[model samples]
Target: MSFSTNQARIRCTQLAPRIGDGPGNLAQIETELASAASDGIDLLVLPELATSGYSLTPSEARDAALPADSPVFARWQAILGEHTSAVIGFCEHGGEDPSGVLIYNSAVILTPGSAPTIYRKLHLWDTEKSIFTPGSDVPPVVDTPFGKLGTVICYDLEFPEMPRSLALRGADVIAVPTNWPYISRPENEHAPEVVHAMAAARASGVAIACCDRSGEERGTVWTEGTTVVGTDGWVTGEMAASGRYDAAVELAGDRRRISPRNDVFGDRRPEFYEL
Candidate 1:
């Protein structure tokens, strides 16, 4: 897709419930995709492990994994092609090496003109460590119908290096599919994940579109701040509650001019940070 110097828009969805109900989840996703298309959004992002929900046992996670040849995946790819570029998460079954793990936590990218690219999550939360093995390689900054795009899973965003690595490698926009819980904290405290994403955006100069699941699942409640933060450290768009909702914003591109005054990348000195 050709990119113009003009504004680039992204629409994010904060999806709720349907955890582990594949058919029902697809219906919800389809409905939202149709709505976002009507709104003329260029891209749409969905939550983490949306297909199977979070907190599944290793066996359950493997059983929930969908094959690449499945109609459900094809249907989603076609839907994404028809509307806007999209990023969606699923727990996937990996290759059968009897000696290896059977499932992986992955985010799949689908655009109008290209084959779907899968990004396996490189980091795993404590519970997940028992099931999915860490991803072995990094995904490239994919060129889609929208622009250069990249993806990360739930816990991956907590570390600063991941997003920064993508930006320095040429990603213009980073799509994060997370299942963030809203555990009660002190009144003035922010969710640590929220703060992590904000700092990542400011440090990388890349637009961040994060979609986290909402509502209770397996006794855990998901936090309710699905947002799109720009490189300028501003919340360009946000969806505060659960259920299906969309947010659109014009994302900046990689062609931005380099300047010393406000150039976040230019001023960094890697040499002094070694500890």
Candidate 2:
């Protein structure tokens, strides 16, 4: 289905969730949701593992994991305005793994009057390999009042194919819930992760909103690189003093025309290239 509107107000809240504090983190998320709803945010993206925080031991992760059908989501849904939607990360308790109750790094899309849509992280990053079981299914493109919303976790955006597949599947916006450990770079350059996001947005002509965490966790400094990239591949929003990045972005339409003679999707010759 086509987007209900062409323009959407998106916000990425760079929150610093304390590790293993599920209740406290839930409170933090509730506050943000209420504020976003009051401010009429069309989409609010929160950092990866917003419910449980990062840098958890396996036992801690298990202790923090919540099932997809958790009642907390219903509470969050209650806080969302009719036109507002949110994508937040959590440690998911249930999985298809036969060995045991495996957890997955997952993001859930919560919209008013609708059931939650969860997307398990397909590509696990570094230590995540030891924590989460990789999702076998592809990411989902969900229908929302603002636009066609797609979701991916931290490391998923690093894979060019991930965003491209979403774009090809008719996603207008890709909401990324990430926790980027700080990596030193040139003084003036954007974090390498942000650079990857920019390139992905440009290549697919789709807006990307990456909500990265802030503050330090377990001695690991965060990039705090929350960013919003418009369809044209440039940074559209900057982190505000309150740690929120807000931007008004245009949603993708029926076509992906970049120039008079070229189209981002129509020009693709996938049959010729081995993915």
Candidate 3:
């Protein structure tokens, strides 16, 4: 699953549909996909909870969830087949549980395949902890036209362990789909989300493609930046305000390859912390 030296270009969007606004969501997604397709992007990453706006109550969220074989999947599948490989977010159900239907903050990898492989969000946000079940399995780095890629949704980006784990398993790019809120208070002055992502990019030594939701959804104002951070911890591409997802980044395979002499993950000292 090695990446080629040839450059691979990726495009993404920071969608902002009104809370529980499904029609607007579909329209926006279709428009973005059409634009990305016209631009000839290899991969297109989108925001988390993209279909159903971020402020939905648990019940509203559940009701807005779509089936895996729904019409939306067919449309997106066609879009991917014609335009580009995409990572789309939607609430997914993983069969019935005694407690109730288990919902996951999931992202589906849409490519030319039997079907999209749904990767459930492992790290849950505060209220999200109560809404979705935490995933236990480690995601595998799948081979895409660009390179070996993997995903982590929203809060997963905050955990150092998440991207590190993916890098250790040999992922060239870590794609994150988020609904991050804008925090401008004095105590949390800096852009915490961007700072955290940069730190993760350096620690993991893999490129990070983070697409976040923008604009006002319900009452929550999100930090509307869709960014790309290279392995060197530099902001390669950014759309940091309430705007469209118009960032493109070229990742070099030669740059991502690690030297045999250097041990990045093998030397980690994890014994200090107990899970």
Top candidate when judged by lDDT against the true structure: 2
TM-score of each model, paired residue for residue: 0.88, 0.95, 0.85
Candidate 3 lDDT over 1-275, as tens digits, reads 23344544576687776666788888888777777677777677888988887776878878778766677877876766653677878777666788997777888877655467678888888888877878777765777766778898988888878887888787878888888888775664436776777888777677788888878866788877677787767777545343544444446544543576654565567898675
- Candidate 1 residues lying further than 4 Å off, grouped into runs, are 1-5, 17-20, 240-250, 253-262, 271-275
Look at candidate 3 and give me any clashing residue pairs.
Answer: none
lDDT-wise, the better of 2 and 3 is 2
CA shift at 91, candidate 1, in angstroms? Answer: 1.0
Q: What is the lDDT of residue 33 in candidate 2?
A: 95
Model 3: residues with Cα > 4 Å off, grouped in runs: 1-5, 185-190, 240-242, 246-250, 254-275
Give the alpha-carbon lDDT of every model.
0.75, 0.90, 0.74
Query: Is candidate 1 or 3 superior in TM-score?
Result: 1
Q: After TM-score superposition, what is the CA distance of residue 250 in candidate 3 from its true location, in Å?
A: 4.7
Looking at model 1, which ten-residue stretch has the lowest summed lDDT?
240-249
Full-model lDDT, candidate 1:
0.75
User: What would the per-residue lDDT of candidate 1 be over residues 143-256, giving only the tens digit for each residue?
Assistant: 865568889988899878899889888777899989887767778866778778777877777778888887788888888667777765556764544354444445565423
Cand. 3 TM to true fold: 0.85
User: What RMSD, rounded to one decimal, does every model reach?
Assistant: 3.0, 2.6, 3.7
Question: Candidate 2: which stretches are off by over 4 Å?
Answer: 1-4, 95-98, 252-255
In candidate 1, which residue pairs get closer than 3 Å at backbone N, Cα or C atoms, i.e. clash? none
